[model samples]
Target: MDLSCFKAYDLRGRVPDQLNPVLAEKIGRAYVEITGAKKVIVGYDIRLSSPDIAEALSSGLMAAGADVFDIGLCGTEQVYFATSHYKMDGGIMVTASHNPKDHNGMKMVGPESRPISSDNGLNEIRDRVLEPFGDAPQQGRYEPLEVMSAYVDHLLGYIDAGSLSPLTIVCNAGNGGAGLVIDELEQHLPFEFVKVHHQPDGHFPNGVPNPILPENRAATADAVIAEGAAMGIAWDGDYDRCFFFDENGRFIEGYYIVGLLADQFLRKTGGGKVIHDPRLTWNTMDLVKAAGGEAIESKTGHAFIKQRMRDEDAVYGGEMSAHHYFRDFAYCDSGMIPWLLVAERLCQSGQTLSSLIDARIEAYPASGEINRTIDDPPKVIAAIEAKYSVGAKSVSHVDGVSIEFDDWRFNLRMSNTEPVVRLNVESRADIPLMEEKTEELLAEMQRLNEER
Candidate 1:
């Protein structure tokens, strides 16, 4: 197996060349051996190669003396749900998420849907896969498990269906795996949905299914305005992350959604702990604190966030990248729950999505996240840290280098999945200051890149 296929958090690489059925089977056997999980759940997305990879993985698991429950043709979160919902020993989803069509991978979880990251156990699995190992003493069993009905019921349990209004919602699945869940959930709710790119096409006829990129967002936004919908939502290929847009067809930054969802969850539970990534902080911190909830700062990435949420027993955790984690969901990130909770909030509060987030947007004006490709990310980061640390009121390395002064702050970090450096800047209700600082940082990064 190519070591590059193993990422910091999950397995993702170009298909066939780096990740395929042969390697996937090896990974499956290695996972069972490393974790000693007896009963495992397996699922796949709409990717053309997913079914084959999932089948190979299950075969390997069964060969390793583990009972395999196949939950065929589902999203990544469904595997997470089934793992904990059925009390399975472990689970694996054969998905490449929003990666390009030529790429594929897997997301693995241990008991209770807890993530299997490099820091936890992925490295051990990697090493074991590379070494030689014989088959188990006895072959295990394989069975099919239907989890759609139960999954839908659990999603509706997050919000009162009676509280939702007869509002029109625009849902763009990006021709990924999200359409299946959306179609199922629509039957249990009263919202009028305008579906765009709704079919599950492994070819991704619409695009790569990543709504974070500006090029991939127009469909959802246009549909929201064209259909006069209350709000618009879009998800990645595997449907583990969802993005939101307002009724006016304006794409809302995921940072404000974090604050909105944090406030709602805090209010719903009467007060609890909330976890947020360091990339964007002020708004989440302020909203969480105001709701009488303890706000905890965690490193970015789903694995780190989920572990921190479990450690803090946090009611909710959100990353500006559109991943939302719930304590009740076994500390796993769910793309479905965030929209449901937000829709319920809009209904109960009798406010448009715009109004609900406008105040927070003004209060903590921010530059949503800016990514810059540089020759040497470390050198640029060091330069930024050295240039700003002197006058900064405080500095933190929880995930990246975050420096703050009285009125403004920014977090600069290199991307784990890409060669770009990401910068997020925010200020106390000053849009101009935020913009100025963002430009200043970009200029410095560009200068460093030229020097390199």
Candidate 2:
């Protein structure tokens, strides 16, 4: 039995060979046995193999004496929402979440939608899959649960709907599941949605919905320009993370969005803690401070951010990777809430999206996360840290080494699942300085790599 599909955070692998209905059923039973979850929320994405896999998984849950509340064909966050909102014991979302169309996986959460990563119960569940299993004495029941109406209302609650005036907004679903959500929210909002690639198709005609890549962004950017939309939004296959494009068709880096959202959320709450990743900081720190909100830095990754959000009782948390967590939403990340809040801000302030972001870009110029394939990441990173930390004002390793000077800073961190190192450099209102440092750092990393 190949259990390679089980990952550090979730399950992700090619279908049938690595993950199939049989293993899914076993995983479901294992999940029930491990967590003792009597009631479970089961949901799946728009992948071709999702329905069959979800069905098998539900069977396993029932066999293990867990009643399955099937939320059928929704985003990963929906599972998170259902599990926490309805007080379910746990939830499982069958999705690879922007992985290749041929691949499939699952994202699991325990009570209160707290992530069940390797540090928690995911690894134990994986190990238990190999053990034998028999049906419980009393079989559990299955019910088709419809929570979309309530879910949509919950999403709308995050913003002032009356303040949201008419604006042309471009939404490119990329043939993923976000369109279903946009359609549901459309009736209640005042924005004119210019829908592009708006449909649920597991075939992924416009390629996988990951807008993180430069190549994957043109469709949304072009649509924004062609339609003269106020702003454009794009989501991954599962719609858990959303990317933004300004009114001028320029893709806004997720770092800036973090700052913008922090400011917006702080205004509503009066003052609260905002959890942010360490990779990029100056901009978010500035915004949070101005908003009268306490800025707290957490190590990058959903599990870390979510846990910290829970610990600090933070009102909101964001990663430069585009995951935004909300306290009201059980500390889970939501792709939909961020956009709505941004739109409401635009409506109230009567400011264009590009104009709002341009000021921040000028205030803090950053080298958007640059990745380099280093033969030895640790050695390269350590050498870089040693050389740079000499005259630096401060050096912190909350996630990876982040060295800061009086007016400039840079974070050097290695990818969790790859042999590549990601570098981000920023300067206080100086693009040339930021660019020069970025080049200097990359060249130094190359030199360090070659020395060994």
The C-alpha lDDT values of all candidates are 0.92, 0.95
lDDT of 1 by residue, 104-135 (tens): 89999999999999988999988888987688
The runs of at least 3 residues in candidate 2 whose Cα sits more than 4 Å from the true structure, single-residue gaps closed, are: none
Q: What is the number of backbone collisions in each predicted candidate, taken in the order shown?
A: 0, 0
The TM-scores of all predictions, comma-separated, are 0.97, 0.99
lDDT of 1 at 262: 96
lDDT, residue 361, candidate 1: 87
Highest-lDDT candidate: 2
Candidate 2: residue 330 lDDT (0-100): 93
Model 2 accuracy (lDDT, Cα)? 0.95
For residues 1-452, write the lDDT of model 2, one tens digit per residue: 99999888999999999999999999999999999999999999999999999999999999999999999999998999999999999999999999999999999999999999998999999999999999999999999999899999999999988787999999999899999999999999998999999999999999999999899999999999999999999999999999999999999999999999999999999999999999999999999999999999999999999999999999999999999999999999999999999999999999999999999999999999999999988899999999999999999999889999998999999997667899999999999999999999999999988994
- Please give the range of 10 consecutive residues that has the lowest summed lDDT in model 1: 1-10
